[model samples]
Target: MLKIGITGGIGAGKSIVCRLFALLGVPVYDADTRAKWVMHHDKALKQELTEAFGPEAYTEAGELNRIYLASVAFHDPQKLELLNSLVHPHVGNDFTKWVEANQQAPYVLKEAALLFESGSWEQLDEIIVVAAPLDIRIKRTLQRDPHRTRHDVEAIIAKQLEEEEKIARAQHIIYNDDQQLLIPQVLQLHKLLLSKI
Candidate 1:
């Protein structure tokens, strides 16, 4: 089984690309969603969070306190790194188990916004980067998140690896700009991956 990492900057339409892959019967593990789940259910991770961020890391009902954690970590780079350090390992372990369970799959996608930043890309067999123009990405993000301003979106884009960098490192690239038809690009990649398998 091939472990493929799908990544792009915020608003680059990575989710849309991943959904297309899922439609083709590909096993897609969304790292962000799984990270949240692991943070809530993994006992060791919960203890680490509590120790790092104090008891407010989770509520009495054993739910992660996102607001509290964000407030404590977001403003401090060191705190944010510590948080990622704690969570990434658990997510990696979870991904390993998920891959084991899907050993029959030809390829599996692990979609994450920070695949490279978290160093998870090192574990994948290949990487597919979804790319789009900055203006288009900002517009898409604003449309998807009504509460976020253009500045907020731009800030996020700034924090991510540059589009040129991601494209240079990726084994495949799917353009999501309005000018390109996404389905065909995805289909072509799907066929190519199938051939490889």
Candidate 2:
């Protein structure tokens, strides 16, 4: 199966584009959501987290203490890298199983906000970047996240690969800047992928 990666900076409408692909019967693995699940359920991952961050990583009820984990890792780059090192490998393993289960698919999409940053793009056959103007992206994010200010959105964008960089690296691009109609572009890509199959 062709493993396609769909990535974009925060608020670039990656999820919406993935949803369009999902409608066409393509299996979509949402990396962020699955990563959270892996962090909470993978035994070795939980053990590594406890070792790195102490037992406070999980609560008495065996649930991941997100607040505690974020407090320890969010502000410190090294701590955050440690956390990702432990978590991403498990997520990658889970994605491998997910792909096996959907082996008959013409293509499977792994949608991630940090596909390039996490170095997961190397595992995929092609990458589709969903792009929108920075201002438009910020506006969309603000509308979606009511509590986040423009500065908060900007900070997130600053951490992600620049829009130009993602576009330059992508094998396919989908524009979600509101001026372009998204479905036709998605359909075109969908047809092309099917033809490749």
Candidate 3:
């Protein structure tokens, strides 16, 4: 089965594109969601997290403490890198197992905001980048996340791989800019991928 990595920066409509693929019966593994699950359920990974970030990584009830981990890792660049180093391997392994279980599909999508940054793109057969203008992305993000200020959204965009770089690396591009029709673009790509298999 072909494994395609789909990535875009914050508010670039990656989820919308992934949803379109999912609607076509494509197996889509959302890396961000799976990473959170692996961090909580994988015993070895849990231990490694505790060891790296101290016991505060989990709470008394054995749940992953998102706030604590974010506070510790998001602020310090070194700590954030260390955190990714620990988690990405486990997430990668999980994706491998997931792909094995999903072998019957024509293709599978590994959707992640940090596909390239996390090094998961290396394992995929190809990449699809969802693109939108920066201004539109900011506007869309603000509308979707009411609690986040413009600065907060910008900060997130700043941390991601540049839009141009992502587009340069991709094997396919899906434009979600307001002027374009999303379904037609998705259908075209869907048919193209099916033909590839």
- In the order shown, what is each candidate's alpha-carbon RMSD? 0.9, 1.0, 0.8
**Cα lDDT, all candidates:** 0.93, 0.93, 0.94
Q: Write the per-residue lDDT of candidate 1 for residues 1-197, one digit (tens) a residue.
A: 78999999888999999999999999999999999999999999999999989999999999999999988987688998999999999999999999999998899999999999999999899999999988888988999999989987887787688998999999999998899999999999999998897
lDDT (tens digit, per residue) of candidate 2 on 1-197: 79999999888899999999999999999999999899888999999999999999999988999999988987788998999888988999999999999999999999999999899999999999999998889988999999989987887787788989999999999999999999999999999988887
Deviation from native of the Cα of residue 5 in model 1, angstroms: 0.7
Which segments of candidate 3 are over 4 A away from where they belong? none
Clash count (model 1, backbone only): 0
- Give the clashing pairs for model 3: none
Top TM-score prediction, candidate number = 3
Which sections of candidate 2 miss by over 4 Å?
none
Model 1 lDDT at residue 119? 97
lDDT of 3 by residue, 1-197 (tens): 78999999898999989998899999999999999999999999999999999999999999999999999988788999999999999999999999999989999999999999988899999999999999999999999999999998998888899999999999999998988999999999989989998
> Worst lDDT window (10 residues) for model 2?
151-160
